[model samples]
Target: MKRIGAFLLTGAFLLMNVAVMAQCSLCTKTAQQLGEGPAKGLNNGILMLALTPLVIIGFLAFRWWKSNKEA
Candidate 1:
């Protein structure tokens, strides 16, 4: 299970270079003005920010599940 999770994480990281257009209207307009490179950076920043919470929740859930399974 741990190995599978690690493999999936590695794959996701490797594939993360593909453009993510996850910007609000204002951010989208700002990124458009900033051009491609900056826009991509902005998108990646947003994506990471969004994923941080999900990753934390997933880790906590995994721990909880593991403890329950052990019990």
Candidate 2:
């Protein structure tokens, strides 16, 4: 039913968020291991900032498309 679909969607979103967090942690660890703590953090910050727009756009597009789809 609709409830099940909604639950699945929420779960999928949660899982995706967790995956991204895991990847971010891995990136941080790799940078630290390479002896570039400060540099790595800055690099990550810069990367995130640079990708912010793309992420936003993608999310917006996805939401727009999803909302328009018929059940």
Residue lDDT tens for model 1, 1-71: 99899999989998885655789999999999999999989988999999999999999999998999999
Top-TM-score candidate index: 1
Per-model TM-score, in order, reads: 0.70, 0.39
Output the number of the lDDT-best candidate. Answer: 1
RMSD of model 1 against the true structure: 3.1
Q: Write the residue-wise lDDT of candidate 2 on 16-68 in tens digits.
A: 73323323666667666777566556566766887889789989998998888
Candidate 2 deviant stretches above 4 angstroms:
1-35
lDDT of 2: 0.70
